[model samples]
Target: MSLTAPARLGIQLQPQHATYGQIRDAVLRMEDLGVDVVFNWDHFFPLSGDRDGLHFEAWTMLGAWAEQTERVEFGTLVNCNSYRNADLQADMARTLDHISAKGGDTGRFIFGTGSGWFERDYDEYGYEFGTVGSRLDDLAEALPRVKARWAKLNPGPTREIPIMIGGQGEQKTLRLVAEHADIWHSFVRPDAIAHKLDVLARWGERVGRDVSEITVSNELSRGRLDDDHADALYDAGVRLFTLGISGPDYDDAPVQHWLAWRDRRNDAVGVDAA
Candidate 1:
C-alpha cells in the first residue's frame, strides 16, 4: 500500500426513509460542498430504522443522478450482482457513464458492485437466497461477462468505466478485486486495513496482477474520524474515505466536517483535494 493518491471524501446518501426529492437535494448539496464522489446503496428495504420504510431502487436513481449532477462522480456504494443480469448491468453502467459525461472528457460513474447479501431482499423479490459461497461464485462468473458486454456495446463507455468492488472477504472477494477492480472498498476499521491489504496483495500475486493501482477505500465513522484514525488509514494507504448518510432530512453537517478534514489531509500530503 502506498500513499500516492489524493485524499477524497465520498457520501453514500442512503435512499431509504426519504422521498426522492430529499435524496436529490442532498446529492446537489454534497456536490456543492465539494465532496469528491456521491453514492447510494442498492437495497429494497431500509437498512436501518424501519425495515419497511420508504426506499428507492439504486440504478434508476443513479440514472437521474447522472443527468442531474455535473461535477461529482456518483454510483452505488455496492450494487447487488444478483439483482440484474450481468450483461444488463454492464449496459446500464455504460449508458449511465455516457449520460454523466455530458460531452465532457470523462464520465462520472463508478461501477461499485458486490456479491449480493441481505436475504430479505432476495426472498421478497423472488430471487434465490443462496449460500454466501454460491453468491460469490455467481459474482466470479459474472464480472468477465460484464467486461465482454462493455466491449460489445454500440457506443462504448465514455472512458474506461472505473470498477469498484466492495467487501472484506479475503478469499473470493479479494481475489475478484485483484482480477477486476480499479477501486477496492471495505468497512474494516483503520487498524484492520493492513491485514486486508496484505491479503489483497497476496491475491494479486497469485493472479499475477499488480493491485497497487487499485485505490483503497474505507468508511468514515463520525465518532472516529479524528486525526489519529485518519492518519492511521492514510499511513496504511487509504485515499478515499466515505461516509454513509441516511435520509428523511439528509443532513449535510457531518459531510461538511469530513470535507474539511479531507482538504486538510490532502494539503498535508501535498495532493490537491480538488
Candidate 2:
C-alpha cells in the first residue's frame, strides 16, 4: 500500500452452492482478471445459505486447481490444523507446490493455515473437536513439524512455499506468526490493525526475529473495499486485500470493482514520484 510493494488482490471463491465445473470456470475467470491469489476455505459444509448446500472439499479441489490454471497462487484460506496429520498436511502442501509448477518455473502455492475452528467440520469428519486452547497448542506444535517435514520431503518443494497464518490471537497466534509466518492474514478493523501490529512486533522481539518484512494481509467483506477505511488499512501497511465470492453465482462484480481500485492505488505510486 505504501508502494513499497503493489497491493495484491486475492479472492476466496467460496466452494458452495454450485457444481465443481462452475467452480473451475470461476477460477479461470479470476486468473484472467489478474487477481494474485485464489483461496478456498477448509470446511466440510457450506458456511452460508442452506446448511447442507452443495459444497466441495478443499485439498482435493486444490489438486485440480494446480492443473487448471498456469498462473495465480492457490491454497486454503486457512487450513484446519486438526483435520489431518501435521506431516500429512505438509506432504499435501508440498505435492501441490510441485503440481502447480509449470513451464519449468517455481510453484504457485501459499500454505495459508490456522488452528482449526468450525466444530461441525471436526464433528462430522471424526476429528477431535478439542477446546480452543488445545487447538491452538496443537497448531503451535504442528508448525515446527510442518517445517521439519518439508526438509525431508523427496524433491522438496520447488520454492520455500510462503506460509500465511490466519488469526490474531495475541498470545499463541501472534507468537506463531512471529516465528514462522511469511504473511499474517487477519480481518481486523482499521482502528485495530495498528494495535495488532504493535502486539506482533512485541512477539517478534520476544522471538528475536525481525517481523518487519512479513506481509500484512487483510480481508474485505463483500462491498466494503471502497470505504474510506481502506485508506486507513493501507496506511496501516496492509498490502494484500482479499474478498470472498460464493458459488452458484460466483458474482465477480465486487472483484472487478476492487481490482480497479487496486490499479488506482498502485498508479499513485508513479504519480508520487512524478
Candidate 3:
C-alpha cells in the first residue's frame, strides 16, 4: 500500500498466428534483452485478430520456456482454472519450477492464475460454460487444493512458487488475491489503481493477512509506454509493467523500450534490477 517496489518489465508473448519455432525464438530474444519476466496467456484459441487464428496452448509452451530460458521468470499471464484439475496444476507448476532452476537455486516460475473467462475457450474445448459466479466459485475452491497438493508433492517445490492472481474484482477476486497471491495483476486504468488497492487492503484486514508485500501489475498500453501513466501507477504501488506482443513476427522494439524505461525507473528509485 506504500507504493514501493523495484521496477520490473514483463512481456506476454501471445501464442497466436505463429509457429512454435518463432515463439521459442521470441522467448530467447526477450531474455537476452533483459526483460524481467516473460509470460504467455492460457487460452485454447486466439484472443485477438482472427478468432480462428493459429494459436498454441499456454502450459505446453511454458514447459518449453522452462528448459529454454535461464534468467527470466516465466508463466501464464493468467491460467484459466477451469481447464485443468487443481492438484495437477500444482504439480505442473512445481515440475516447471524445478526445470527452470539452475546452479542449485530454485527456478523462476510464477504460478499466475485466474478464474476462467473467455467463453469460446470453454465452449470449444468441451469444458462447461459456467456462469461467472460458478467459475469464480470453482477458482476459490481450487486454490486451497492447489496449495495442499504443492505441500504433498514427492520432492516438493524447489522453492515456494510465487502465486500471482490476475483480476480486479473488488469482491471475490481481490479477496482471493489477499488470501493467496504474492503478486496481483490487472489491466485497470491508472486512476483506478488506488481504489482497487484500497479494496485489496480491506480484504487483507478481513482475511488477517499482510498484503503489503503483494506486487502490483498492469499491462503496457497499445501505444508506447507513457511516462505520465507509468509514473502515476508507480506512485500508486505498481512494480511490474507487462507488454502484450503477438506473432508471426514477435516484435522486440516495444519490449526493449520498456526494459530501458524499467532500468531508468529502477535507477531513479534506487531499486536494484533483478
TM-score, every prediction: 0.97, 0.96, 0.97
RMSD of each: 1.2, 2.3, 1.0
Error of 1 at 164 (Å): 0.8
After superposition, which runs of candidate 2 have C-alpha atoms over 4 Å from their true positions? 1-3, 223-225, 271-274
Minimal lDDT window, size 10, model 2? 265-274
For candidate 1, the 10 contiguous residues with the lowest summed lDDT are 221-230
- Check candidate 3 and list the clashing pairs: none
Q: Relative to the unseen true structure, what is the Cα RMSD of model 2?
A: 2.3
What is the lDDT, from 0 to 100, of the residue 102 in candidate 3? 87
Q: Number of clashes in every candidate structure?
A: 0, 0, 0
Runs with alpha carbons beyond 4 Å of true place in candidate 1: 222-225
Candidate 2 vs candidate 3, lDDT winner: 3
**Residue 231 in model 2: lDDT:** 71
Assess candidate 3 and give its TM-score to the true structure. Answer: 0.97
lDDT per residue, candidate 1, 125-202, as tens digits?
Answer: 999989999999999999999999999999999889999999999889999999999999988888888889899999
